[model samples]
Target: MEHKILGVIGGMGPKATSVFFDKVVEKTEAHKDQDHIDMVILNHATIPDRTSVILEKNEKMFITAIKKDIELLEAAKVDHIAIPCNTSHYFYEDLQKMTDIDIIHMVDETVKKIVETYGANCKVGIMATSGTISSGIYDKSATKFNIDLSVPNQTLQDQIMKIIYNDIKNDLTADTNEIEAIIHDFIFKQNCSCVILACTEFSCIKLSEEIQSYCIDAMDVLVERSIELSGKQLKSLQQNKSNAAII
Candidate 1:
């Protein structure tokens, strides 16, 4: 089978890009080597802070960075493309207009899956970047399917952003257990069916074996959906290639 390469416009911070790739590999149902989708990881760290740009309403630097990445991915002739950064998706329309490669909407697919697996009105606690919150990306996703959306209070929101920017983004694993416990509290106390990891960095702190058991990782679904839509076969993922090859 011909290998289909999926392009990643990443490096809003390298950690999240790495996590996204790991999940993409893990989510692949490949049983053989050739069945996995090849990837082009363009770690364009030159893109400025999306949260600040969005909040500050300064997109020139961010837009330029995205266009550079889009142009790079298109020139690489990748079969499809996905942006790992959640906040950067705010410029999806702008980049999509410039690129010929299909741009997969990662959050939209996660929301659709949530609605299908849970229910239309499922209560979900969102953990995301400030930009993502301000942009109402998750809110938009929830509203599309009539799902209930809740975010951390202003204080907690600021704390979450710090954890993401300071701890995860900087590659320093700050103890987010206390913060995550509060999130866990919301899941049970507030009667949320699950929590949504709206920020890519939040995925890192979610490494707790306990938290992993509770929160649903929207990133996994996004990657799996990208693979499916990218026309990648199910056999060539770096791991389990032999087992999934038959598929």
Candidate 2:
């Protein structure tokens, strides 16, 4: 079988990109280094802040940076690509026009997973950067899936922003208690069945067990789709168990 080369357009915040790549490795069905999928990772840490570009209406630099990354990936001959950052997906359509290579839609895949796991019309909470929430990228997919979407109030949203930018991005320790409280409010007060960690930065933090059961990481969805589209199978349930034993 011809294995497809997967391209990762990453380093929106840097750490999140590393986490996403780690997840892909952990989830792939590989016994040897050669069994792993071929990957090209462009850790373009120079890409400007996506949230700022949207809010300030200064998108030229952002678009140019992303387009350059895509061009580099295309030159590398990657079969498909995935971007870990959700906020950057605001320009997803435009990016697609710049390249023929398939860029997997992280938001769409997360929304589809929510509907598949929770059912249509289920209430879902979004925790992301201000730009992602404002752009309504996930909202569009939610509408398509008939899923009701809710977001943190402005005050809480600010807290989330701080966690992503100040904490995770800066390599500081994330406050798990704060994240847990936010999830609790979404579930109990807002009546959401599940919360989507719509920001790639969230992948850097470890969620509490209780919250883990009710939360979905958008980055994980992207990783799974990246593997599938690249013609690789995710590690089977039984294989995962056996691998754990070998550790």
Candidate 3:
């Protein structure tokens, strides 16, 4: 059987792109290499910083670069496209209009999963770039689903930006304390039922198991959707099926 092709528009930060690719491969349930999904990956590492473009209110350069990627994917005959960058979803509608093929909405899929897993009344905390937060991408989706949101204040948000850009993006070690403290506040103080690791950069780090329970990684959601949409079974799902049969 021919598996559907998945097009990836990546390199918002190179590490995040690598992790996303690894997750797709690791999570896919394939008996052999032939069973794996075919992919077209464009590591557009030089694409401008998404947060800066949104804050600067000048998106022409970012749009132009990504548009080319879309056209290329369309020509490649990809069944669907997955952009692992959460901040780039700020320009989602325009990006979608640029191609007939579907570009998986990472933000929307994350929010929907949160509601389905935790229920609509749950308060969600967002940990993302200033651009994604300021653009109201999560807020818009949460409101539509009738879920409450708890975002980091200016100071906390600044710390997150430093970790994302100053540290992770630069290949320096990050101080994971900032991430822990923010998650603590959201879950304990703000009474958020769950916190979203909304930025792809967060996926590149290791969070403690305790901290992870109260958080959802948006990248993981995107990965699951990408694999399924590309006509592959998730490894986790395949395992569950095997266990059920044994029972």
> How many residue pairs clash in each candidate at the backbone level?
15, 0, 0
Whole-model lDDT values for every prediction: 0.78, 0.89, 0.90
| lDDT by residue (tens digit), candidate 2, 1-247 | 4789999998887888898888888889888998888999999998999999999999887998888888899999999999999999899999999999988999999999998899999999989999999988988889988999997789999999998888878875799999889989999989999999999888888877689888989988998998888887899868765775687
Positional deviation of 23 in candidate 1, in angstroms?
2.4
Question: Best by lDDT, which number?
Answer: 3
What lDDT does candidate 3 reach at residue 180? 87
- Per-residue CA lDDT of model 1 for 1-247, tens digit only, reads 3557789988867877887887677666666776677889988877799999999989887888678777788888998888887787788788788877888887788788888878898898888888998998888878988999888789888888778877777765868676577578778888888887777776655466567655766677667777787666443445544543545
TM-score attained by model 2: 0.95
Worst 10 residues of 3 by lDDT: 238-247
Comparing 2 with 3 on lDDT, the higher-scoring candidate is 3
Candidate 1 lands at a TM-score of: 0.88
Per residue, candidate 3 scores C-alpha lDDT tens digits across 15-75 of 8889999889878888898988899999999998899999999888899988889989989
- Who wins the TM-score comparison? 2
Models ranked on lDDT? 3, 2, 1
Candidate 1: regions farther than 4 A off: 1-3, 233-247
